[model samples]
Target: MREISLAEMPGLLGQEVGVSDWITVDQTMIDLFADATQDHQFIHVDPVRAAESPFGGTIAHGFLTLSLLSAMNFESIPKIREQTVGINYGFDRIRFVSPVRSGSRVRGRFTLADCRFRGAGMLMTTYDVAVEIENERKPALTASWITIVQFDPKDRPEGV
Candidate 1:
């Protein structure tokens, strides 16, 4: 993970970060997510019944793919230099492009899309993350994530 100062990130407005290693979305993973989130939809839990559904098998919940973000960011996480705090500023456009069926592999490709100055010394940045399926043309998920990094807590920007 390359560390770049908020100021230096301006030139990286459209650079794609390296892709994360593949992660399997198996029945157990979906089941665990279902249990954790208390979303016991039959299409996500019962494989036999799911096999008869339009999805053709148990499918991972859309939120499950979204939930993988923390892991993706943490594992080999990139650090923004010259910033004291990096806050998750939320996403803009989010789309579940395709289903992540049980036993499928997925990974993320992050692209630094935009950067802007905010209050004091804070910098706002946007990342376009594509959750790609193994050997597939269609992505499993597409999300635009916003982040705010400040040189000091006092430099934090006001809410939008």
Candidate 2:
């Protein structure tokens, strides 16, 4: 991942931050996610059944796609220097626009939508993220994801 000084964060507002490397969503990965999440939905875990459905074959669960953001971020997004920890704050909005078929390659494109001081030593960052399905016209999902990053108090600027 790219590392940038915390001081440079404010300058990144509304900028396209990064694009992650492609990851293939195969049946094995889909089945494991279903099992872990206890979803066991046919469209996600049953290829034969899913093949006859509207998607034409097994598709990854929407949440599974959503859950990949952190991995994708680690692969390409810029990190703040001296940030000790980052926590998933939540999503302001999320939309599943297209199905990610099994064996499909997907990648995340992130934009630094907003940033704000949360407390004395924390910064809340929001990203506009799009999960693009390889060779597909429509993206699989789009979300406004937030993360709270903790930096050393000594690195924090004085005042707001």
Candidate 3:
């Protein structure tokens, strides 16, 4: 991950943070996600059945795409220089805008939306994230994602 000081983060607002390397969502990956989530909708798990549906073939689950944010964020988002830990702070909003067909490749593009000192050596930040399906006109999903970074009091900059 790229490393930047917490003090430098505010300057990055409204700017693209980074783009992640591409990853494929193959049938096996889709199936594994289905099994783990206990969601067996034919559109997601049955290619034969899905072929007859409007999507023309099986598609990845929305949550499966959503789950990719963690991996994508890890690869693309900047890390705070003095942070002792960072946690997923949950999303403010998410929308599945397009289907990710089996075997499709996807990548994330991130923009820093906002950042603020929450309190006591804690920082809260938001990212505007988009999951783009390779060669597709529309993105697979978009979200406003939040994260919290914590630093030891000693590591925090003066007055923060």
TM for candidate 2 is 0.96
**Reference-based TM-score of each model:** 0.87, 0.96, 0.96
For residues 6-112, write the lDDT of model 1, one tens digit per residue: 54577777888556778999999999999999999999999999999999999999999988876776553367767787789899999999999999999988888
What lDDT would each prediction earn against the true structure?
0.82, 0.92, 0.92
lDDT of 3: 0.92
* Cα error of candidate 3 at position 64, Å: 0.3
Model 2 over residues 1-160: C-alpha lDDT tens digits? 5689777888999899999999999999999999999999999998899999999999999999998888999989987787999999999999999999999999999999998887778999999999999999999999999999998888986655
Q: Give the alpha carbon lDDT tens digit for every residue of 1-160 in model 3.
A: 6799977888899999989999999999999999999999999999999999999999999999999988998898877889998899999999999999999999999999998887778989999999999999999999999999999766666655
Instruction: Report residue 86 deviation for candidate 2 (angstroms).
Output: 0.5
**Candidate scoring better on lDDT of 2 and 3:** 3
Off by over 4 Å in 1: 153-160
- Residue 60 lDDT in candidate 2: 98
Model 3: number of backbone collisions: 0
lDDT: which candidate is best? 3
TM-score of 1: 0.87
Off by over 4 Å in 2: 158-160
